[model samples]
Target: MRITRALGAALLTLGLAAAPAAADTPSPGPSDGKAPASAGTSFRTAAEIEQGQRATAGGSAGDYLYWSFPADTGQRPTVRATVKLPGTHAAETWRIDVYDGLRRRQSCQYGAQTRTAAAGASSVELACVLRTVRAWAEPWANDPLPGTYYIRLTAVGLPVLDRGLPVSAEVRVDAEDIGGPAAVDGSLAEPLVPGIATEDLADDDSRAVLFGLEPDDGWSSGWWSDRWVWTAAGGVLAALAGVAGYALTRGPGRPSRVPPGA
Candidate 1:
């Protein structure tokens, strides 16, 4: 009876542990049909600094590394965002909201006007012209300790208009700026390239090694490169080099051979 009771208790404990995990596991799909994965817009890492050191402020010399901010506390700092709408949606209205790490509603702006598609096309270019529009709540003012927050953009009335289309840049906030809005003087590093796309973005290791950044695990660097394919290529090159080195060091000789049927 005691053994059965103990077994029951063990099973109960295991079930309890599994319950939280099942709840915690994130669902890969959207919550509802309201929003699907966005395919048009993209995310970029504007400015990121993994560690601090004294460098002449501004002018691209000591810019932050590439990464998104509000990683685990407070709100993310906002920077310039320029979006090119697809030449499909005729004239669309959109709203963008920035939230803290905890998914709480933060600062939001409505009616960032987007120009209509120029007659022949159905999309337009929209840029944030405001001199530092407030996108996130003051990092400190957040009820939940602010952390890496998400920038969500939605097109009102047009659920399919621009939802899930990822668009935004990561503006890293320094230790001092934690729980506070970024300073006007705070700035983002220059882009890796002029146009937006994976081709124009930086590689994860390359960006970190170059800019000196260390972001939280699982954070997308917003840079894309085919890692596995490149790795295989590198291995092939190394093998070829080894073969060449052996041939060169072996010295020319009429290759030694054993006597037939010795």
Candidate 2:
């Protein structure tokens, strides 16, 4: 009995020891499918690069431009944009237009329906908002060929700065489909702590999904973390230890007494 108890204790301790390692392993970060196309090349903003010198009156807010899938082609590209107006902005003065990379024509437009914003408050957001009046757009749907595109802003009708609307346009490419970006390997080699259900892991079609995109053929399909296998191994070790302990502490089953004939 004592031996059995000792063995059980040892196994429980080992199992407890292994658990910390499992917890320490980092999991994967959140992804929106698609891979890195150009070391973060796809997206840009007015302040992100050279400022456009062209100035005009009625410049909406501080000149900024963003792009996204103008039309949904199964996969929609998203961009981050922000706009700033001079002084106290008036209404309906700012306009951001997305142009096709090949055609160089208007693909889509994001216009402010309300009045201009204050110096500090003259910004609106769409999606992927990061500082400024960030918003998102898609030029891919406008049948944009794979190449650099253009974003233009017009403040021609609203207000202007002391030196015309100091309008600027910044642009960049956002996430692509799982196979588009090359940087992403599409693998969950990194474990999600505790235990993520197979269903949840399987449903993700992000860039990481490319890890198993190709048919497995004879090989196993779907993703399976090695962590679970390790845990099962630990369970087996514990069970063996318990059995060994029971055998060591157990006496003869009958508890034999002295023979009367002797």
Candidate 3:
């Protein structure tokens, strides 16, 4: 009991000292997103941009804001925006959309698309997350890739009373690196080729390693590609047609069609 009491005193003393030290340390400010231009229309024309920087700007209710940020390979990109609605926008709704490097709309894997303030509230925040955007995603899949991404904010369904009022918002983008693919095993790896299916590289044959398939083999293994399956179906249909012809010509079990003129 005496030792436990002494240990508790030491822990209390350490916590008190750490509190002051932490308070003395300066915290970082949100200054990463900086617009390069005074005004712009699209992602390419976004004014300020930098990772983790919460750039802010003011505009009228109908104004639109765009921003861009870089998302590196093996990183999960995140975007967040807070809109301070004016008296006119209290009833108006707002949306935050994410786009890829080529200005394509990105799917929201893990975040809210719209953030609307309550009827009496004056502000709302929207958050978005792109889960594990593959660096070498399949060509058919429009998964987010490692490249410049864009965020677009707009106020929709503006009320008649809020057309002329001003509005403001803050936007911040981040690409947090969580780690690479699980198959990597934390080791050095070769470069990745986009659109190359990983399954094609699992085999050791030269065909699978080089071209991802054998020259004489087909990829489709389903019944739709089996010639024998279709042949049997055709034979069944032919038998049914022959029986129907025999039934109609024989007329009530007369002579079961013995060829020439029944």
Highest-TM-score candidate: 3
Per-residue lDDT tens digits of candidate 3, residues 209-246?
21221111121111121233334545654655566666
TM-score of 3: 0.54
Which 10 consecutive positions of candidate 1 have the poorest summed lDDT? Answer: 54-63
Off by over 4 Å in 3: 1-39, 182-262
lDDT of each: 0.33, 0.35, 0.57
Relative to the true structure, candidate 1 reaches a TM of 0.28
Please, what are the lDDT tens digits per residue for candidate 1 over residues 54-165?
A: 1111111111222223332222333222334443443445444444334455542323433333322433333321112122334464432323433433344443544444
Candidate 3 clashing pairs, residues 3+ apart or interchain: 32-53, 33-53, 34-48, 34-49, 35-47, 35-48, 36-47
Off by over 4 Å in 1: 1-68, 71-76, 108-145, 159-262
The predicted structure with the larger lDDT, 2 or 3, is: 3
lDDT of 3 at 214: 15
